[model samples]
Target: MNLTVDIGNTRTKIAVFNGEQFVCEEKFEEAAPQHLLDMVALYSPDKLAYCSVGSGQPAFETALQKLSCPVLHVTGETPAPVTVHYRTPHTLGADRLAAVVGAITLQPETDLLVIDAGTCITYDLVDAAGNYLGGNISPGVEMRLEALHTRTARLPRTEADGETPDLGYDTETAIRAGVVRGIGYELQGCIRHWQKRYPTLRIFLTGGNRYAFSNAVRQNILTDSHLVARGLNHLLEMLP
Candidate 1:
Protein backbone atom coordinates (compact mmCIF):
# COMPACT_ATOMS: atom_id res chain seq x y z
CA MET A 1 0.00 0.00 0.00
CA ASN A 2 1.05 3.61 -0.71
CA LEU A 3 -0.03 6.87 0.89
CA THR A 4 -0.19 10.19 -0.91
CA VAL A 5 -0.56 13.55 0.82
CA ASP A 6 -1.13 16.88 -0.85
CA ILE A 7 -1.06 19.99 1.29
CA GLY A 8 -2.73 22.79 -0.59
CA ASN A 9 -3.21 26.45 0.27
CA THR A 10 -6.43 25.87 2.19
CA ARG A 11 -6.71 22.14 2.77
CA THR A 12 -4.73 18.94 3.10
CA LYS A 13 -5.68 15.69 1.33
CA ILE A 14 -4.54 12.20 2.20
CA ALA A 15 -5.20 9.19 0.00
CA VAL A 16 -4.43 5.52 0.46
CA PHE A 17 -3.79 3.39 -2.59
CA ASN A 18 -3.31 -0.33 -3.06
CA GLY A 19 -1.16 -0.56 -6.13
CA GLU A 20 -2.96 1.65 -8.72
CA GLN A 21 -6.33 1.44 -7.04
CA PHE A 22 -7.40 4.17 -4.61
CA VAL A 23 -8.70 2.62 -1.40
CA CYS A 24 -9.85 5.61 0.61
CA GLU A 25 -9.13 9.32 1.10
CA GLU A 26 -9.50 12.06 3.68
CA LYS A 27 -9.44 15.84 3.73
CA PHE A 28 -8.59 18.26 6.50
CA GLU A 29 -8.70 22.00 6.83
CA GLU A 30 -5.06 21.77 7.81
CA ALA A 31 -2.69 18.89 8.40
CA ALA A 32 -1.59 18.25 12.00
CA PRO A 33 0.63 15.69 13.66
CA GLN A 34 -2.39 13.84 15.02
CA HIS A 35 -3.90 13.56 11.57
CA LEU A 36 -0.75 11.96 10.19
CA LEU A 37 -0.51 9.65 13.17
CA ASP A 38 -4.12 8.53 12.73
CA MET A 39 -3.64 7.81 9.04
CA VAL A 40 -0.45 5.91 9.76
CA ALA A 41 -2.24 3.77 12.31
CA LEU A 42 -5.11 3.03 9.94
CA TYR A 43 -3.28 2.29 6.68
CA SER A 44 0.27 1.39 7.65
CA PRO A 45 1.34 2.14 4.11
CA ASP A 46 4.83 1.07 3.11
CA LYS A 47 5.58 4.10 0.93
CA LEU A 48 4.47 7.72 1.24
CA ALA A 49 4.50 10.50 -1.32
CA TYR A 50 3.99 14.10 -0.26
CA CYS A 51 3.66 17.44 -2.02
CA SER A 52 3.01 20.88 -0.59
CA VAL A 53 2.74 24.47 -1.78
CA GLY A 54 2.90 25.98 1.70
CA SER A 55 5.80 26.33 4.10
CA GLY A 56 6.75 23.09 5.82
CA GLN A 57 5.26 22.44 9.25
CA PRO A 58 7.82 20.77 11.51
CA ALA A 59 5.31 18.92 13.64
CA PHE A 60 3.72 17.29 10.62
CA GLU A 61 7.14 16.34 9.25
CA THR A 62 8.05 14.81 12.60
CA ALA A 63 4.87 12.77 12.62
CA LEU A 64 5.57 11.48 9.12
CA GLN A 65 9.11 10.50 10.18
CA LYS A 66 7.68 8.52 13.08
CA LEU A 67 5.59 6.49 10.62
CA SER A 68 8.82 4.73 9.60
CA CYS A 69 7.83 4.70 5.93
CA PRO A 70 9.98 5.80 2.99
CA VAL A 71 8.63 9.29 2.35
CA LEU A 72 9.15 10.89 -1.06
CA HIS A 73 8.70 14.65 -1.01
CA VAL A 74 7.86 15.58 -4.56
CA THR A 75 9.85 18.54 -5.86
CA GLY A 76 10.33 19.90 -9.36
CA GLU A 77 13.66 18.09 -9.57
CA THR A 78 12.19 14.80 -8.41
CA PRO A 79 12.03 12.11 -11.06
CA ALA A 80 8.60 12.16 -12.71
CA PRO A 81 6.86 9.77 -15.08
CA VAL A 82 6.51 12.57 -17.62
CA THR A 83 9.01 14.79 -19.44
CA VAL A 84 9.02 18.39 -18.17
CA HIS A 85 9.58 21.13 -20.75
CA TYR A 86 9.19 24.13 -18.46
CA ARG A 87 12.11 26.55 -18.69
CA THR A 88 12.16 27.14 -14.91
CA PRO A 89 11.42 23.65 -13.67
CA HIS A 90 12.24 24.57 -10.08
CA THR A 91 9.36 27.04 -10.02
CA LEU A 92 6.78 24.56 -11.32
CA GLY A 93 4.12 23.68 -8.81
CA ALA A 94 4.36 20.12 -7.47
CA ASP A 95 0.57 19.77 -7.52
CA ARG A 96 0.47 20.67 -11.21
CA LEU A 97 3.17 18.16 -12.08
CA ALA A 98 1.44 15.48 -10.06
CA ALA A 99 -1.86 16.22 -11.77
CA VAL A 100 -0.26 15.78 -15.18
CA VAL A 101 1.26 12.48 -14.16
CA GLY A 102 -2.12 11.35 -12.88
CA ALA A 103 -3.75 12.31 -16.16
CA ILE A 104 -1.25 10.31 -18.16
CA THR A 105 -1.64 7.36 -15.85
CA LEU A 106 -5.41 7.48 -16.26
CA GLN A 107 -5.54 7.91 -20.01
CA PRO A 108 -2.07 6.85 -21.14
CA GLU A 109 -0.74 8.16 -24.51
CA THR A 110 -3.07 11.02 -25.34
CA ASP A 111 -2.96 14.77 -25.53
CA LEU A 112 -4.19 16.15 -22.20
CA LEU A 113 -5.33 19.48 -20.78
CA VAL A 114 -5.51 19.22 -17.00
CA ILE A 115 -7.43 22.07 -15.34
CA ASP A 116 -7.15 22.42 -11.58
CA ALA A 117 -9.49 24.93 -9.96
CA GLY A 118 -8.29 25.31 -6.41
CA THR A 119 -6.66 28.33 -4.76
CA CYS A 120 -5.75 29.17 -8.33
CA ILE A 121 -7.07 28.00 -11.71
CA THR A 122 -4.22 26.14 -13.42
CA TYR A 123 -4.14 24.72 -16.95
CA ASP A 124 -1.37 22.21 -17.59
CA LEU A 125 -0.91 20.35 -20.86
CA VAL A 126 0.82 17.06 -21.55
CA ASP A 127 1.39 16.01 -25.13
CA ALA A 128 0.76 12.47 -26.33
CA ALA A 129 4.50 11.98 -26.32
CA GLY A 130 4.51 12.57 -22.51
CA ASN A 131 6.12 16.05 -22.59
CA TYR A 132 4.65 18.44 -20.02
CA LEU A 133 4.15 21.88 -21.53
CA GLY A 134 3.57 24.51 -18.88
CA GLY A 135 0.08 25.94 -18.47
CA ASN A 136 -1.37 29.24 -17.21
CA ILE A 137 -2.71 30.27 -13.81
CA SER A 138 -5.40 32.77 -12.86
CA PRO A 139 -7.16 33.93 -9.71
CA GLY A 140 -9.67 31.36 -8.44
CA VAL A 141 -13.37 31.95 -7.80
CA GLU A 142 -12.92 32.61 -4.09
CA MET A 143 -9.89 34.80 -4.73
CA ARG A 144 -11.84 36.73 -7.36
CA LEU A 145 -14.72 37.29 -4.95
CA GLU A 146 -12.34 38.30 -2.17
CA ALA A 147 -10.43 40.58 -4.50
CA LEU A 148 -13.63 42.34 -5.49
CA HIS A 149 -14.54 42.93 -1.87
CA THR A 150 -11.05 43.98 -0.78
CA ARG A 151 -10.31 46.22 -3.76
CA THR A 152 -13.52 48.19 -3.51
CA ALA A 153 -15.57 49.70 -0.65
CA ARG A 154 -19.13 48.83 -1.68
CA LEU A 155 -18.71 45.42 -3.31
CA PRO A 156 -19.46 42.66 -0.83
CA ARG A 157 -17.65 39.31 -0.71
CA THR A 158 -20.35 37.05 -2.09
CA GLU A 159 -20.35 33.27 -2.15
CA ALA A 160 -20.91 31.67 -5.54
CA ASP A 161 -23.92 29.35 -5.55
CA GLY A 162 -27.25 28.84 -7.31
CA GLU A 163 -27.47 29.55 -11.00
CA THR A 164 -25.29 32.20 -12.64
CA PRO A 165 -27.10 34.36 -15.12
CA ASP A 166 -25.66 35.67 -18.37
CA LEU A 167 -26.05 39.18 -16.99
CA GLY A 168 -26.55 40.43 -13.48
CA TYR A 169 -29.89 41.98 -12.56
CA ASP A 170 -28.59 43.70 -9.39
CA THR A 171 -25.39 44.39 -7.44
CA GLU A 172 -24.96 41.03 -5.68
CA THR A 173 -26.17 39.00 -8.62
CA ALA A 174 -23.94 41.02 -10.94
CA ILE A 175 -20.86 40.19 -8.87
CA ARG A 176 -21.80 36.51 -8.82
CA ALA A 177 -22.49 36.42 -12.51
CA GLY A 178 -19.35 38.30 -13.40
CA VAL A 179 -17.04 36.09 -11.36
CA VAL A 180 -18.65 32.69 -11.92
CA ARG A 181 -19.88 33.10 -15.48
CA GLY A 182 -16.72 34.89 -16.51
CA ILE A 183 -14.63 31.95 -15.32
CA GLY A 184 -16.95 29.50 -17.06
CA TYR A 185 -16.50 31.35 -20.33
CA GLU A 186 -12.75 31.60 -19.85
CA LEU A 187 -12.48 27.85 -19.25
CA GLN A 188 -14.65 27.06 -22.25
CA GLY A 189 -12.53 29.30 -24.46
CA CYS A 190 -9.34 27.65 -23.28
CA ILE A 191 -10.70 24.18 -23.96
CA ARG A 192 -11.90 25.21 -27.40
CA HIS A 193 -8.51 26.64 -28.32
CA TRP A 194 -6.74 23.53 -27.15
CA GLN A 195 -9.14 21.25 -29.00
CA LYS A 196 -8.43 23.13 -32.22
CA ARG A 197 -4.70 22.67 -31.73
CA TYR A 198 -4.92 19.03 -30.69
CA PRO A 199 -8.04 17.58 -32.23
CA THR A 200 -7.98 14.56 -29.95
CA LEU A 201 -7.17 16.43 -26.77
CA ARG A 202 -8.61 15.04 -23.55
CA ILE A 203 -9.74 17.54 -20.90
CA PHE A 204 -9.49 16.64 -17.20
CA LEU A 205 -10.80 18.89 -14.45
CA THR A 206 -9.93 18.55 -10.75
CA GLY A 207 -9.36 20.54 -7.55
CA GLY A 208 -11.65 22.23 -4.98
CA ASN A 209 -13.83 24.33 -7.25
CA ARG A 210 -14.25 21.70 -9.95
CA TYR A 211 -17.86 21.05 -9.01
CA ALA A 212 -18.61 24.78 -8.92
CA PHE A 213 -17.84 25.21 -12.64
CA SER A 214 -18.16 21.68 -14.03
CA ASN A 215 -21.74 22.19 -15.14
CA ALA A 216 -20.86 25.44 -16.89
CA VAL A 217 -17.81 24.23 -18.78
CA ARG A 218 -18.84 23.50 -22.40
CA GLN A 219 -16.53 20.69 -23.29
CA ASN A 220 -16.25 16.93 -23.21
CA ILE A 221 -14.55 17.14 -19.84
CA LEU A 222 -13.73 14.44 -17.27
CA THR A 223 -13.65 15.22 -13.60
CA ASP A 224 -11.53 13.47 -10.97
CA SER A 225 -11.32 14.96 -7.51
CA HIS A 226 -8.35 12.75 -6.58
CA LEU A 227 -6.03 13.61 -9.46
CA VAL A 228 -3.09 14.88 -7.41
CA ALA A 229 -3.28 11.92 -5.06
CA ARG A 230 -3.40 9.51 -7.94
CA GLY A 231 -0.45 11.28 -9.54
CA LEU A 232 1.54 11.09 -6.34
CA ASN A 233 0.75 7.38 -6.11
CA HIS A 234 1.93 6.89 -9.69
CA LEU A 235 5.16 8.73 -8.92
CA LEU A 236 5.67 6.50 -5.90
CA GLU A 237 5.52 3.51 -8.21
CA MET A 238 8.41 4.92 -10.21
CA LEU A 239 10.76 4.61 -7.27
CA PRO A 240 13.20 1.69 -7.01
Candidate 2:
Protein backbone atom coordinates (compact mmCIF):
# COMPACT_ATOMS: atom_id res chain seq x y z
CA MET A 1 0.00 0.00 0.00
CA ASN A 2 1.04 3.60 -0.63
CA LEU A 3 0.11 6.72 1.30
CA THR A 4 -0.14 10.19 -0.20
CA VAL A 5 -0.42 13.37 1.86
CA ASP A 6 -1.41 16.77 0.50
CA ILE A 7 -1.22 19.78 2.77
CA GLY A 8 -3.17 22.60 1.22
CA ASN A 9 -3.57 26.23 2.30
CA THR A 10 -6.55 25.51 4.55
CA ARG A 11 -6.69 21.73 4.85
CA THR A 12 -4.66 18.56 4.69
CA LYS A 13 -5.67 15.42 2.81
CA ILE A 14 -4.33 11.91 3.06
CA ALA A 15 -5.17 8.86 1.02
CA VAL A 16 -4.30 5.21 0.85
CA PHE A 17 -3.81 3.30 -2.38
CA ASN A 18 -3.22 -0.34 -3.13
CA GLY A 19 -1.08 0.03 -6.21
CA GLU A 20 -3.25 2.01 -8.65
CA GLN A 21 -6.43 1.28 -6.75
CA PHE A 22 -7.63 3.96 -4.32
CA VAL A 23 -8.61 2.56 -0.93
CA CYS A 24 -9.64 5.53 1.23
CA GLU A 25 -8.99 9.18 2.13
CA GLU A 26 -9.33 11.63 5.00
CA LYS A 27 -9.23 15.40 5.40
CA PHE A 28 -8.26 17.67 8.27
CA GLU A 29 -8.35 21.40 8.95
CA GLU A 30 -4.61 21.14 9.40
CA ALA A 31 -2.02 18.38 9.34
CA ALA A 32 -1.83 16.99 12.86
CA PRO A 33 1.06 14.67 13.65
CA GLN A 34 -1.00 12.23 15.71
CA HIS A 35 -3.69 12.04 13.01
CA LEU A 36 -1.13 11.18 10.36
CA LEU A 37 0.60 8.78 12.73
CA ASP A 38 -2.69 6.99 13.35
CA MET A 39 -3.29 6.74 9.64
CA VAL A 40 0.21 5.33 9.16
CA ALA A 41 -0.51 2.70 11.80
CA LEU A 42 -3.88 1.82 10.33
CA TYR A 43 -2.77 1.56 6.72
CA SER A 44 0.79 0.35 7.25
CA PRO A 45 1.70 1.73 3.82
CA ASP A 46 5.13 0.85 2.48
CA LYS A 47 5.70 4.10 0.61
CA LEU A 48 4.65 7.65 1.42
CA ALA A 49 4.39 10.68 -0.86
CA TYR A 50 3.87 14.19 0.50
CA CYS A 51 3.40 17.66 -0.93
CA SER A 52 2.46 20.96 0.70
CA VAL A 53 1.22 24.37 -0.36
CA GLY A 54 0.78 25.24 3.31
CA SER A 55 3.37 26.00 5.95
CA GLY A 56 5.60 23.00 6.74
CA GLN A 57 4.88 22.42 10.38
CA PRO A 58 7.99 21.29 12.23
CA ALA A 59 6.11 18.73 14.27
CA PHE A 60 4.60 17.19 11.17
CA GLU A 61 8.06 16.94 9.66
CA THR A 62 9.31 15.21 12.79
CA ALA A 63 6.38 12.80 12.68
CA LEU A 64 7.08 12.01 9.03
CA GLN A 65 10.70 11.22 9.89
CA LYS A 66 9.60 8.78 12.58
CA LEU A 67 7.81 6.66 10.01
CA SER A 68 9.76 3.54 9.02
CA CYS A 69 9.07 3.88 5.28
CA PRO A 70 10.55 5.83 2.44
CA VAL A 71 9.00 9.28 2.26
CA LEU A 72 9.02 11.24 -1.00
CA HIS A 73 8.50 14.98 -0.57
CA VAL A 74 7.26 16.24 -3.88
CA THR A 75 8.94 19.47 -4.88
CA GLY A 76 8.92 21.41 -8.15
CA GLU A 77 11.80 19.27 -9.38
CA THR A 78 10.32 15.88 -8.46
CA PRO A 79 10.61 13.42 -11.35
CA ALA A 80 7.25 12.72 -12.91
CA PRO A 81 5.75 11.42 -16.14
CA VAL A 82 5.07 14.83 -17.71
CA THR A 83 7.60 17.06 -19.49
CA VAL A 84 7.46 20.49 -17.84
CA HIS A 85 7.66 23.48 -20.19
CA TYR A 86 7.34 26.17 -17.52
CA ARG A 87 10.20 28.68 -17.62
CA THR A 88 10.61 28.75 -13.83
CA PRO A 89 9.82 25.20 -12.81
CA HIS A 90 10.97 25.86 -9.27
CA THR A 91 8.17 28.37 -8.74
CA LEU A 92 5.39 26.01 -9.77
CA GLY A 93 3.18 24.68 -6.97
CA ALA A 94 3.44 20.95 -6.28
CA ASP A 95 -0.33 20.56 -5.96
CA ARG A 96 -0.86 22.14 -9.39
CA LEU A 97 1.76 19.90 -10.97
CA ALA A 98 0.36 16.86 -9.18
CA ALA A 99 -3.13 17.68 -10.42
CA VAL A 100 -1.83 17.77 -13.99
CA VAL A 101 -0.11 14.43 -13.56
CA GLY A 102 -3.32 12.98 -12.17
CA ALA A 103 -5.24 14.28 -15.16
CA ILE A 104 -2.83 12.79 -17.66
CA THR A 105 -2.77 9.54 -15.75
CA LEU A 106 -6.54 9.26 -15.97
CA GLN A 107 -6.77 10.52 -19.54
CA PRO A 108 -3.58 9.97 -21.49
CA GLU A 109 -2.37 11.34 -24.86
CA THR A 110 -4.82 14.25 -24.89
CA ASP A 111 -4.80 17.98 -24.35
CA LEU A 112 -5.87 18.61 -20.77
CA LEU A 113 -6.99 21.58 -18.72
CA VAL A 114 -6.67 20.74 -15.04
CA ILE A 115 -8.59 23.14 -12.82
CA ASP A 116 -7.93 22.84 -9.11
CA ALA A 117 -10.12 25.13 -7.00
CA GLY A 118 -8.89 25.17 -3.45
CA THR A 119 -7.61 28.18 -1.53
CA CYS A 120 -6.66 29.37 -4.97
CA ILE A 121 -8.04 28.45 -8.37
CA THR A 122 -5.42 27.06 -10.78
CA TYR A 123 -5.74 26.28 -14.48
CA ASP A 124 -2.90 24.13 -15.78
CA LEU A 125 -2.62 23.15 -19.42
CA VAL A 126 -0.96 20.05 -20.77
CA ASP A 127 -0.68 19.15 -24.41
CA ALA A 128 -1.32 15.74 -25.94
CA ALA A 129 2.42 15.10 -25.92
CA GLY A 130 2.47 15.52 -22.09
CA ASN A 131 4.09 18.94 -22.00
CA TYR A 132 2.98 20.98 -19.00
CA LEU A 133 2.41 24.46 -20.44
CA GLY A 134 2.07 26.33 -17.14
CA GLY A 135 -1.18 27.80 -15.84
CA ASN A 136 -3.03 30.73 -14.21
CA ILE A 137 -3.92 31.30 -10.56
CA SER A 138 -6.77 33.31 -9.09
CA PRO A 139 -8.36 33.88 -5.69
CA GLY A 140 -10.64 31.08 -4.49
CA VAL A 141 -14.27 31.40 -3.37
CA GLU A 142 -13.47 32.10 0.27
CA MET A 143 -10.64 34.43 -0.63
CA ARG A 144 -12.91 36.36 -2.93
CA LEU A 145 -15.56 36.69 -0.26
CA GLU A 146 -13.02 37.68 2.37
CA ALA A 147 -11.42 40.17 0.04
CA LEU A 148 -14.79 41.79 -0.62
CA HIS A 149 -15.43 42.17 3.09
CA THR A 150 -11.94 43.14 4.22
CA ARG A 151 -10.99 45.37 1.32
CA THR A 152 -14.18 47.35 1.71
CA ALA A 153 -15.94 48.91 4.71
CA ARG A 154 -19.59 48.27 3.97
CA LEU A 155 -19.45 44.76 2.45
CA PRO A 156 -20.29 42.16 5.09
CA ARG A 157 -18.37 38.92 5.53
CA THR A 158 -20.35 36.15 3.91
CA GLU A 159 -20.06 32.38 3.86
CA ALA A 160 -20.15 30.26 0.69
CA ASP A 161 -23.36 28.47 1.62
CA GLY A 162 -26.81 29.82 0.79
CA GLU A 163 -29.15 29.90 -2.19
CA THR A 164 -27.08 31.06 -5.13
CA PRO A 165 -29.88 32.38 -7.23
CA ASP A 166 -29.28 34.12 -10.57
CA LEU A 167 -29.46 37.35 -8.60
CA GLY A 168 -29.20 37.74 -4.87
CA TYR A 169 -32.33 38.84 -2.97
CA ASP A 170 -30.63 39.95 0.27
CA THR A 171 -27.19 41.24 1.23
CA GLU A 172 -25.88 37.83 2.29
CA THR A 173 -27.33 36.11 -0.74
CA ALA A 174 -26.03 38.90 -2.95
CA ILE A 175 -22.51 38.47 -1.69
CA ARG A 176 -22.70 34.69 -1.85
CA ALA A 177 -24.30 34.70 -5.30
CA GLY A 178 -21.94 37.31 -6.64
CA VAL A 179 -18.78 35.64 -5.43
CA VAL A 180 -19.90 32.11 -6.32
CA ARG A 181 -21.58 33.07 -9.57
CA GLY A 182 -18.64 35.23 -10.55
CA ILE A 183 -16.39 32.23 -10.13
CA GLY A 184 -18.75 30.22 -12.28
CA TYR A 185 -18.53 32.83 -15.01
CA GLU A 186 -14.76 33.02 -14.70
CA LEU A 187 -14.48 29.24 -15.05
CA GLN A 188 -16.81 29.22 -18.03
CA GLY A 189 -14.84 31.96 -19.75
CA CYS A 190 -11.54 30.19 -19.17
CA ILE A 191 -12.87 26.95 -20.61
CA ARG A 192 -14.05 28.77 -23.73
CA HIS A 193 -10.70 30.52 -24.08
CA TRP A 194 -8.79 27.25 -23.86
CA GLN A 195 -11.17 25.38 -26.15
CA LYS A 196 -10.38 27.67 -29.07
CA ARG A 197 -6.72 26.69 -28.88
CA TYR A 198 -7.13 23.02 -27.99
CA PRO A 199 -10.28 21.66 -29.60
CA THR A 200 -9.77 18.22 -28.13
CA LEU A 201 -9.17 19.58 -24.66
CA ARG A 202 -10.45 17.49 -21.77
CA ILE A 203 -11.21 19.33 -18.56
CA PHE A 204 -10.40 17.82 -15.15
CA LEU A 205 -11.82 19.60 -12.11
CA THR A 206 -10.51 18.88 -8.64
CA GLY A 207 -10.22 20.39 -5.15
CA GLY A 208 -12.87 21.40 -2.60
CA ASN A 209 -14.66 23.97 -4.72
CA ARG A 210 -14.85 21.67 -7.76
CA TYR A 211 -18.43 20.53 -7.15
CA ALA A 212 -19.55 24.07 -6.36
CA PHE A 213 -18.74 25.15 -9.89
CA SER A 214 -19.17 21.82 -11.70
CA ASN A 215 -22.77 22.49 -12.65
CA ALA A 216 -21.82 25.97 -13.82
CA VAL A 217 -19.41 24.69 -16.46
CA ARG A 218 -21.41 23.75 -19.55
CA GLN A 219 -18.74 21.61 -21.19
CA ASN A 220 -17.99 18.04 -20.26
CA ILE A 221 -15.53 17.94 -17.36
CA LEU A 222 -14.22 15.18 -15.11
CA THR A 223 -14.27 15.82 -11.37
CA ASP A 224 -12.02 13.98 -8.95
CA SER A 225 -11.58 15.42 -5.46
CA HIS A 226 -8.58 13.17 -4.86
CA LEU A 227 -6.60 14.15 -7.94
CA VAL A 228 -3.56 15.56 -6.14
CA ALA A 229 -3.35 12.54 -3.84
CA ARG A 230 -3.63 10.15 -6.80
CA GLY A 231 -0.91 12.07 -8.62
CA LEU A 232 1.34 11.97 -5.60
CA ASN A 233 0.96 8.17 -5.51
CA HIS A 234 1.73 8.03 -9.22
CA LEU A 235 4.93 10.00 -8.66
CA LEU A 236 5.88 7.64 -5.86
CA GLU A 237 5.46 4.70 -8.23
CA MET A 238 7.68 6.46 -10.78
CA LEU A 239 10.54 6.83 -8.30
CA PRO A 240 13.60 4.82 -9.37
For candidate 1, the per-residue lDDT at 3 reads: 93
Candidate 1 lDDT over residue span 85-154, tens digit each: 9999999999999999998999999999999999999999999999998899999988999999999989
- Candidate 2 on 1-240: residue-level lDDT in tens? 999999889988999999978899999998899889999999999999999888768898788877899999998778888999889989899999888988888999999999999889999999999999889999999999999999998999999988998888999999999999999999999999999999999999998989899999958899999889889999998877
Off by over 4 Å in 1: none
TM-score of each: 0.97, 0.97
Against the true structure, candidate 2 reaches a TM-score of 0.97
Query: Highest lDDT among the candidates is held by which one?
Result: 2
Candidate 2 residues lying further than 4 Å off, grouped into runs, are none
Reference-based lDDT, residue 58, model 1: 75
Total clashes, candidate 1? 0
For each of the candidates, give the backbone clash count: 0, 0
Screening candidate 2 with a backbone cut-off below 3 angstroms (N, C-alpha, C), the clashing residue pairs are none
